[model samples]
Target: MHFLSTYQRIISRLLLVSSLIVTGAMADEVIMPPAVANTASNNVPTVGPSRPKNIIIMIGDGMGPAYTTAYRYYKDNPDTEEIEQTVFDRLLVGMASTYPASVSGYVTDSAASATALSTGVKSYNGAIAVDTEKRPLTTLMEKAKALGLSTGVAVTSQVNHATPAAFLAHNESRSNYIDIAEAYLTSDADVILGGGQQYFTPTLLEQFSAKGYQHISEFSELASVTTPKVLGLFADVQLPWAINDKQAHKLSHMTQKALDLLSQNEQGFVLLVEGSLIDWAGHSNDIATAMGEMDEFASAIEVVEQFVRQSKDTLMVVTADHNTGGLSVGAHDKYEWHPEVLHKVKASPDVIATRAIAEDNWQPLTATLLGFTPNEAQYSQLQSARMQGNEPLSIALRKLIDIQSNTGWTSGGHTAMDVQVFAEGPGARLFSGHQDNIDIAIKMFSLLPQSVQTP
Candidate 1:
């Protein structure tokens, strides 16, 4: 009897091992989407020359570690294996701390963090390319322009927004949109593409034209323009969220256009491209919107990756200003994440809020955005909040989605958490390991001609 039982146990162990192998194979069959898959095929090249001639800085605002992990899971819902590789996966060299000057508090805002990335100076929040004393500082783009190289800024938000503005304009306040626009007109930047038509009046457009800039409002016009200097304003304010944007130009298209224009300079160029809406989505704590924005940003990165492959002399550095919403994937009692639920979300919280106000209905808006009809009590609470005009529609929508999706957020504001930095091409090695955000600007400045280096 003992011999028979021992033999049976051995057979059971073998069967278990076979079953595990089959499950692993089944998991492997669940391939990643083409968008997030590794396209380079492990052909990432090493730095050929001493220093890169051109530098492209891409900022995905509020893209923290959690955001990347969530995006990977959302794109490829693996049951056993790790999430599929993204464009960033191949280039990730280090992480950076994003704290600003003491005057700005511990959690840095876009302006201060971008200032650190552009000028290598830590300034208070809302101060663009300025020191803590409000003194203007030279930026990487300025150095590029001074060296007779081209410069540009492209973004999914207003051209005068904090991130892009820090590279081109110096002001004590980021909210000075008109002043920022004026500064852009007088700057040496060759290409500027983004929203914020409201900030650029007929006078400013004439100024741009007088400066030999071809101002374009439509994507078709933007694509056809062969001018080295182009200004594209696609919307009145911030551009539409990716999930709701259908008519406007995509971020990837803007990035390609910027690259085409900047590459015209034989001496090389410095360009900043920002995925600004990712920050907005994080602030709203909307997972679906965040996923849409992240996907769009990744697509932009793919475009830049192709450029990096072809132009070996160009260096690309991608990082974030800070984290927002304190986003986490799992919830209490839930060991698994349901990124698939994000697909059912139809619109951003901004869209839902606008529609609710315009149509004077909350039930259908909630159902449409959250993919579930609210209970009678829940509907009444939303209706009451909307009627009172005290509770923000975004907060209400976020609360509802949180309850349904099991996603968690600590706050609606920024966090001091360190963000990832991915770099490739010449000088990419300098960005590896833990460092402060200002180190990026310092290293890029070191690579420029000595004559253009700030004292």
Candidate 2:
């Protein structure tokens, strides 16, 4: 009898592991582990903690620890002996695991991670607030709207992108851009600011106008938006990178505008601000652009931090969905990494490469944009890459930058690494220490006026 009981227990454990490994379609057959199963009753507080009247959640897409560390060095004062601390350093409270549902393996995509962060539910890769079985999960933004609180999303990417889509809409796949864009018509977000003008049709614009939304396409027009409901699409797609942007601190500027509009509601508000292009720069392995994006994100954080300090009744949480590109400081067994080399770059590699390709005397143009002239070997490398096409030339330029700066990258994909969590103001203590990505949302749910029941 003892032997039989032991054998059965072993079988149960294996079956549980197997179930998690299976696709989302089969995940329903297995019970969740105790931690996730008992989360609502055990961790989600209802009455004890001080609930903030307002909440601000910021996501620095694909920013890992290395990215923060790199940013600190990138912005360091060479003349000063000690490295300058960045905004991320002052507010960091803890770390969070960014793994997706068992079906998608350990590493997570933006869609799944965003769903986890926004809805406090684990889902398969590419899912937009839908569970493994394609069931729509209620998001925190939806909850905020239901409670008659103000809600808004500000991002560098299109407002219909995965991160924002998870919070505002439910879809089977993030690639369904049109569906996601259409869903925003009823999202009830008061301040919608980002790119993707190509997705919003004339009919949709008319509908938005009928709904009392003031629409504008230029960044300057944001200053004249006095109405609480506004739609600002600054680019046809994702906004230009910070390095190439005409306006300095574009994300910070947008965040300030959103805050100005959302704060008008006396019932409180929930704002989601995403530094969306950090992930894109990481994916391209463009160190210069990545640093520029991080700078913009940091500036935005500073804006939110000041608001939190002033409001006192507000809580602000900042974190990343996942680490992209497996970024490392030093490569090829080098003892030193030089972030200062990147300080000279004035534009993204793609732009530099494209212009270089067009110019007959490409060396002068490349040197002007890069802030430094290429050596004989790098010149040969760029010439060889230029023979192929713009993309290859851009890749070659990035490689040259990597060599000069001693930057390292594992892959042009997401990594199963932990991301940092930074918080401030009321209810910030709850996010301190280590937790899962879903736990971040769960804690935020606890701070709401009402409890969030487990689904």
Candidate 3:
């Protein structure tokens, strides 16, 4: 009888150990800490029946829930017992579907998704601030302007890029950069800060100056210019990835500048700030670049949080236009995550690609960037690709890194996954629960002061 009892105990103990291992493996796939609950009873504050005097909408381009999760783990090093809370974690209101019009299929592009968020209407892919039929639609910024409030846009990408362009420029196609730049002359946004200096030629600069707009390129010029109507073109095209250029004009600095100028308007302001390169990083499948961009974005949110505390009447909403890369945290081994390995990465794939293509060698560059020598198979594949000279070096490097890190990506394009939405201050309650992307714009319009609600 004693022997039988002992055997049963041993079996029970073994079963428990097996279960624990399974649970640990599952947990490793999603290294993010359990969400800090933001229930209405505890998390949300009591704001009475008052309309917000100002609205600031921040878009984390291509920032899906997975990106947020990956960033949280990356920033906090989730392997530790203590983890820090990200700004988005504290303010998470709800999730929003990112599907566009049926004609555009299930996965919405940046242009279509941004238009939906800006104008409360579903539009085909590639359409910018226009309906499916290519008709111009009034945007939240335009409405805010009509209501006598100042408006502005700040982004990490070119100002004429799809996401930012959807907010202020109406075009049949998002690729029409020249047309988009021309629209800015009539946009009358109080402040415009970003790259795309090439889009605004010398002639356009003179035209802007004639219309009481101060155009500046250098960061110093942007800082010193006190003019309310300012145009800051910081780079010839899209700004360098955050990881590549730390000293360049950062998104947080640009946000602060835009706020400074827009606040000068007594009638309040509506600003759209986008962490545009988060999408690009995802597209490149570069985890290091994504982390750098997310860190900058979090810094910008911190600035906005400070602004919200002081103003008390500002409605701040943060969301993503779409999910890019379909990035998954872990792949080969369910019980493993290697966020720390990302620290070893020093340069973006683009930089490495440029060098590798120039030198006609990939092994040395890959070793330097990844902090390890490539294996026999990787070296052979790279050599063959170089011999062929058809595949992009960046693409080849990204594939190699993806395998090395055990990171998984569905494609080099956007995904139809629902993205996170976080809101704080007046009318934040409207943002809770599952919602369509268009619902955000509708709710914002509804919350506008009654006097300025009309077109």
Q: What's the CA error at residue 132 for candidate 3, in Å?
A: 1.8
RMSD of each: 15.1, 8.1, 14.0
Q: Which candidate is the best by TM-score?
A: 2
Global lDDT of each candidate: 0.79, 0.86, 0.80
What is the per-residue lDDT of model 1 for residues 2-112, given as tens digits with 9 covering 90 to 100? 123323433443333222222333212212212222332334232222557789999999998899888877888556576678887888999998888766667999999
Error of 3 at 379 (Å): 3.3
lDDT of 1: 0.79
Question: In terms of TM-score, how similar is model 2 to the real structure?
Answer: 0.89
lDDT of candidate 3 over 1-455, digit per residue (tens): 11233234334433332222223332122111111112123322332334678999999999999889888777885567987888989999899998887787889999999998898778889999998789898898888888899999999899999988999989989999998999999999889999999998889899999999988898678779775898999899877787777665389999999888888877789999999999988987877788889988988988998999899879899999999999998887665556776667777777766666677455687688767677898887776666655346666767777776677788789999999999987667667778778778766765565455424
- Report the lDDT of model 3 for residue 47: 29
- Alpha-carbon shift of residue 427 in model 2 (angstroms): 0.4
Q: Which is the winner by TM-score between candidate 1 and candidate 3?
A: 3
Q: For model 1, what is the error of residue 99's alpha carbon versus the real structure, in angstroms, after optimal superposition?
A: 1.2
Evaluate residue 257 in candidate 3 and report its C-alpha lDDT on the 0 to 100 scale.
90
Clashing pairs in 2: none
Better of 2 and 3 by TM-score: 2
lDDT of 3: 0.80
